[model samples]
Target chain A: MSRVQAIELVYLFCAVCFIVALKGLSSPRSARLGNIIGAVGMTVAVGATFATPGLHRIGLIVVALVIGTAVGVPAARAVKMTAVPQMVAAFNGVGGGAAALVSLAEFDRGHASFGTAAAVLFSTLVGAVSFTGSAITFAKLQELMTGRPIVLPRQREINAALAVTALALVVWGLSDRSVTAAVLLALVAGVLGVLFVLPVGGADVPVVISLLNSFTGLAVAATGAALRTTLLIVAGTLVGASGTLLTRMMSQAMGRPLSSTLFGALTATASAAAAGPDDGADRSVRTGTVDDVAVLLAYAHRVVVVPGYGLAVAQAQHTIRELADLLESRGVEVVYGIHPVAGRMPGHMNVLLAEANVPYEQLREMDDVNPQFPLTDVVLVVGANDVVNPAARDSPGSPIYGMPILNVDEAKAVVFLKRSMRPGFAGIDNALLYDPKTTMLFGDAKDTLTSLVSAVKTA
Target chain B: MTETTLGLFTIFVLSVFVGFEVISKVSSVLHTPLMSGANAIHGVILIGSIVILGTGHGAVQGVLGFVAVVLATVNAVGGFVVTDRMLEMFKGRARK
Candidate 1:
């Protein structure tokens, strides 16, 4: 085959690899193999691009690749497990930035049809938004900024004005096909991106991150259209479609509509729960000791463990697993109730617990575990708040009213392992905390679970 | 260069459906890893960066292309490595 034909063949192979990679990743059996296949595809594609006829500045390109690997490899390696969400956001932001620059460079070269020019501007705008949006998301997750929704006065008008202005700039950039016009459009879009993400509550950040991932994919697809690269178009659209679907599914799992999550702040219905739970210092809660909790757990016929972000935050998944093992040894059945939003994102708890060597079969998803809670003798809630809040189902006027929750209140008794009575990521009050049947153990999750393990042994 | 926009548009549309169908049934437990893996796959934008760099003829475009190359490399390399690390725990004893 000719060189051009050979390159196209390799691109086709890379595309197939990506498809298989996704297919394998969705199942528990072949996730690692799928990732390896994707890497191989990436390596071959990069190598083939270097060999393309008429390629220039080979030395500089090699240097850039080396520098990128040097910076990226260490950061990915060193991040703690709990920080994986922010790390993913960091990588996503860079990808979006890259797509924008590629579109900008293509525009600067001054070779474009009107059709391609429009596509070029589209890529530049969306890519810039994705980059900045992902950066803000990273900041929120990393605690570099306040995770609560930040709404400025008259924010709705400002957001609308920005969108209209960005649209006008896109048209202006396309009419003349000037690089300066394209650059201006990118700047406006970047500001719009920050405002768009700033108002989303902390509980909804994962959905926004997924949406931004779709934006980057959309931007890359536009680059493909501008450059007439079929592979880029196909690959980019695949991610755009899948990312959009994933975002929808995640929001659904939380029982919140996707529109409300993204635009809720721009409208009047933003969660008033942003103030967080009211101070409950005057309200009495039955605080229990290790011995009391241990006796309760040991005597229970079936204990269900509910893990949330707190469990991940305190790095206590292993300790919790130890307590579960101790209970199981006494013929007390144990299962982990995993809320869909338990960690920072969907399926996040699975990763955290897997690291602690917890068995996969014992991890029960929300739907499966919800019906079983009534039969459960005791429900152990670890480092989680919003997912178990009864207001999600009972209080229609509550901020999280429509959201589905783990029916922990149905259990005979509830025990919470928490650091304090603070609100969860969504900053909403949980009425379940004050339920008379509920007992609170205020301390670090690891320390509490460690003490519970020892206490259960002596019980 | 000979291909029509209509043809490119067709591939893009078909790819979207295939994308939806491929991972539609993924269990919720694997959603985070699946999202990360998908994030890494789009790092294929690296190839687009390489192509742009090859087409760069001057200092400005060269530097633009260089930065694009570096950013895309971080995305592609960092994305895959992080995803691999996340999925690493799911093997060997993941099932038990």
Candidate 2:
């Protein structure tokens, strides 16, 4: 077979592998295998491309590969899971940027018809935005920048001007005879990227990630079109579509408008932080120990566990599952209240819980499990904070106001596992901790839960 | 590098980085949010497909464009619905 045909076949294989890998990733049991399959497919695809013509400049290819491998290998080996988001952000941004670079380079090499020009402009816009936006996201995740919203006065006006200018640049680039305009537009887009992401509070990270993923996919499709490659078109389109859907889902989960998130409205300003104690009607000053939490759970008919970022930090899902198992042994009903936006990603809590061997049926969504909280003997909150905070419902001035929170605060008794009084990603204090019936178990979630499990096992 | 080579490089690099994510267990607190956030980035597919449709000209392109638009819309709608359902969990309180 000709090299072109071989490359096409490789692309087909890569596409198939991506599909399989994605399917595998849908469940925890097969996620590892899925990742491996995807990797293999990608490897095959790359090998096939090497067979393509013009790409036979062996020296350049070898050097690029060596440099990429050298930089990529150690970075991958060293990053922590907590830093995973930043890594994902940086890598995803690079993918979009690469696609944009390919499209630009190809445009420079000839594909500059009016239609192609528009496509290039659009792709560049999307890719540039994704690249810089994701970089900011990485910084936030890395704690290089505070995850709190950074809203300036008259922020909307500034955003509006940036959007208008970017659009104008695109129109100008499409009509003008110069490439300089496109370069200028790219710079504007980079600035817009930082501006867009900086104001979004940490709570909206899932939406941001999804949005960036969409950009990467879209950029790839554009790259495909620029290269006149049908497979790139298909693969890129699929990824873009899936990514878009995921973003909308994340936005809905958070009950925030997509436009606002993109435009930077989620930031909690200094004024809002200072007004915390004025709204005291539903204030909770509650506190408790593992023994106190145990007593409440021992006689209770049903207990629901709400796991959050805290649980992920404590690496305590297994222990939490063990505690739940013990509770089940004592005839206490156990269910998990999984918030869709519970962790940094969609279905994050589910993945973690499933890893710990938590039963699928017992793990309920927020809607399915919210009503059951009233009858719950105890609500065990493991390593979660903002997700369960009452401020979302009770305080309008609160940073998390209007955002839905887990209903654990409404439980007959609430037990919180925390390291200290530190705020959540939004960097705001939780009022639920101070509630009368609430108890704080201050320690590592895993260790504390282990202790609680042993106490219950012996009791 | 060939397109195929680049694709392979992407996969290996991503997997190694992704693997580190699973092992380092750093910033465990952000995992849930990060996952959801990453999931959201998947929406680029919608935007990508839409732009492709926008560029199509012939009858074949028209059909492809229509398909892309439909798929993108469905993705956007379905994703939001699932997300909303998840958010409701954080509402209200229970009296024990």
Candidate of highest DockQ:
1
- Shift in Å, residue A332, candidate 1: 14
* C-alpha lDDT of all candidate models, in order: 0.85, 0.62
Note the chain A TM-score of all models in turn. Answer: 0.65, 0.61
What's the C-alpha lDDT at position B12 in model 2? 33
Query: Candidate 2, residues A185-253: lDDT per residue as tens digits?
Result: 777888888888887666566578767876777676666655556455655665565556556555643
Question: What is candidate 1's DockQ?
Answer: 0.53
Give fnat for candidates 1, 2 and onward, in order: 0.74, 0.02
What TM-score does each model's chain B reach against the true chain B? 0.90, 0.54
Model 1 chain A weakest 10-residue run by lDDT: A273-282
List each candidate's DockQ score: 0.53, 0.04
> What is the CAPRI rating of model 2's predicted complex?
incorrect
